[model samples]
Target: MSVRLRQATLGDLPLICRLRVQRTAWLAARGSDQWTVAGKGRPIEIFAGEVGRALDAGETWVAEVDGEPAGTITVNRRSDPGLWSPWELAESVVVHFMIVDLRFAGREVGRHLLDHADRLAERADRAWVRLDAWTTNSDLHDYYRRAGFQLARIAGPGAHGPSRALFQRRVVPAHPARTAPSRYSLQGYSGGNSAM
Candidate 1:
């Protein structure tokens, strides 16, 4: 079983874009250039243009928890033309515009989303699940590294590029998979350790 990844519809635009806005604000508060208005993120016009194209290509999917939108991801078969070499584009599925709602920050929703992406890659016979992360965000880099990706290279010398740090991991969602515990099992204990 995998997290439900549904094809996004026109009606889902508000939820999707809202999550992006939330993530943009979250990153800014952390002093990260991951997605700010100063060109780390695309201009609104370009962002909407990419969304339209991805929707047309049927590459956008939303992970909904309990019938409510929780996050969005775009797994494109082609890499961004300016960021990756043509050879890299052919071998892997490129993950773009991933945004998880701030409320789901520590719930492993993003991991589950990536698991869904892994299944997509597996079915497509792709060798890897790849993404371009923001270059200066070492914290974000470490996050992906913990999720099993390896750094390939820092792709650009300047700040004005579309996610310059490339990372990849083989589509190996380890079986018995790293999953959240049954919520029922934690009923007796608060998140904090009382004994401590």
Candidate 2:
């Protein structure tokens, strides 16, 4: 099956909530009890709160595979209060939260969502795309690395009850439309820069 990414709408809130619940359960199963720390209540309530706000503000995306909601993401332009890095938060776009059903874990849906979000960020003239994952989940940290994000730094054990490490990938400025090619365009330059 193939997964596709699309802008999220208000109607998607319900499915997004369900996905968050599954994600919380899955995370807890892996010994990351952070989700349960907030109480045994449904984690979707909190996820829905964030997703709803993002959707209303027009900053959400969803990934679907064969007509099923496989994953969801909320990309915001604002930094969480007191949680912003002086360097990374200067950008216009940030990934606040993202999750995929365990059933769709290895299908590359998350990478597709990231690619879509990157395009959206570039279109908005954003300088970077950033996110935070639990520091204890090395496996998830490696997953983000594989998705082309470089580690930024660790933030405190916030209300989420887990130490989180921020990650970021810088977005280069997009070239403007031109009828004639510029002289500096495609000149002799090696691709060995560390920027990649």
TM-score of each: 0.81, 0.77
lDDT of 2 by residue, 1-196 (tens): 8787777889999887777667767777777653454533325576578678778776777889997888887776655544556565555466756777777888888877777667656665566778766666777778889888888777664533353567788764445452343221111112100000
Runs in model 2 with CA error above 4 Å?
A: 38-43, 156-163, 172-196
- Candidate 1 backbone collisions, by pair: none
- Flag clash pairs in model 2: none
Q: Rate the local accuracy (lDDT) of all candidates.
A: 0.68, 0.64
Report the poorest 10 consecutive residues by lDDT, candidate 1.
187-196
- Residue 179's lDDT in candidate 1: 44
RMSD for each of the candidates: 11.1, 8.6
Across residues 1-196, which tens digit of lDDT does each residue of candidate 1 receive?
Answer: 2346688866777677677777777777878756665744676567767777777667778887777677888786666546667777666677878788887677677887787667666555566888888777788788788888899887765433647888888888444343443211111122200000
